[model samples]
Target: MGYFVPVEPGVNLFVEDINQEGSKTIVFIHGWPLSHKQFEYQFNILPALGYRCIGIDWRGFGKSDKPISGYTYNRLADDIRMIVSTLQLDNFSLVGHSTGGAIAIRYMSRYSGYGVSKLVLIDAAAPTGFTKETAKDLLKETLNDRPKMMQGITDTFFFQYITSSFSDWFFQMGLEAAGWSTAAIIKLLRDEKLDADLPKIDKPTLIIHGIHDKVIPFAQAQELDQKIRNSQLVPFQYSGHGPFWEERDKVNQLLTQFI
Candidate 1:
């Protein structure tokens, strides 16, 4: 796919360019600890449905130039803006998940791109009073032993995503998916708070959350649904934070409707 979009100096905004001639653009933003790779199902499936899907890898993740700094929501938002402007994209949609959702919201609140028309939050992350309090305490225990912490997060971060096929392969996969320092990851945990910016959003919004989401929980999704004025919440009966990953067919179907 010719993925090329630089967010800023020293911060490479990673992108998976699906089409240049498609009618409308649907940019996919990935979550913390995951890069554009997370949108594999959508990137490959949605284009068949006549939607241009471009998944972006934030500076510290994916194929982008991962500098030591520039992992905050503000910096990440700037990276997204750069991708949009650099590509000259218009009348587009943004599907962001987890931390990526927070990044999209930051972009919407700050920079309304030339043609960004719709926004979808797939278990999207928002401040709405959600905190990385869990991460904070967890970080303390694992700061001195990242590999041990990474081992512990194998399931918590990915659910029953563990397996013999991937086996220990998925271990490092989780670690480098979105390259970030402990401080940066902790910073993202804190950035999930969006109370000050949700009301300012002006685009049509779709909030999809799994009923069984243990990572972000359903209440946060409910709070997001209640807060976003033009937003609608779609409950996935059996899934977690990465419903799109767990249920691509369903997620793509709803995305088709939403976009």
Candidate 2:
């Protein structure tokens, strides 16, 4: 079942809660410029394997309501908290991709991971917020010319050997997000300090990162593993930033084993 779960008055997040009897819940958090659709692969297959999936599009992305503000990490984490509390979710795992991974880290740290059992970080933006000093220059350029910067990001980070249809779909999904919202979110990410949040995560964590990731480097995964005490790092040898799409079978197999 899917509904707009209220985060604040007049601000509700679109959440998809797929319930399955006798199955564990896995809440999926999508990355920036994308929606819950980012985890479509997992949602399609995980439930039949005795795992229910919950995917929520962050505010200003996907089908979620877009306010003029509130794109910061703390605010996003609170939104997730509202969903978990509203659904009475317990003993579940949180799987976050890209910026969603940073939000997951904030959620656990801010809320102390109240009902979470484990965490899965897939090519996530972690410990270090955006990972490059050059990102500051990019963000500046993005503020001036969003469309141009977005095209550069897509070309350099997103598509590699993927088909035309897949790449087109990615571009379409990104286009669904508002330009102002994208800028605000990027500003928050650029300014965020998550080093303290990393160690606060006291759950069994699995970090899966693509070795060839240019968006958020592969070294960040190693850094995350080092910070999170009880965490395992799994490198996707041939995959890039989008492992779930680039190496779906391998990622799914590894995820199943981890959980």
Native-structure RMSD, model 1: 2.5
- Top lDDT: which candidate number? 2
Q: Estimate, for each residue in 87-201, the C-alpha lDDT of model 1 and write its tens digit.
A: 8877899888987888888888878533679989877767642356766765664466666666665566444364755436545654664334544756567655677678877
Position 86, candidate 2: lDDT: 91
Count steric clashes of candidate 1.
Answer: 4
The reply for model 2, stretches above 4 Å from the true place, is 131-145, 158-160
The residue-by-residue lDDT of candidate 2 on 1-259, one tens digit each, is 7889999999989988776573688889998878988777877777778888899988898899999889889999999999998989999999999999999999999999979999999888877656357567667766787667766666766434867687677777876777778878777767787899988899999999989998889999999999997999999887888888878888777777877
Model 2 TM: 0.94
lDDT of every predicted structure (CA atoms): 0.73, 0.84
* Poorest lDDT segment (10 consecutive residues) of candidate 2: 151-160
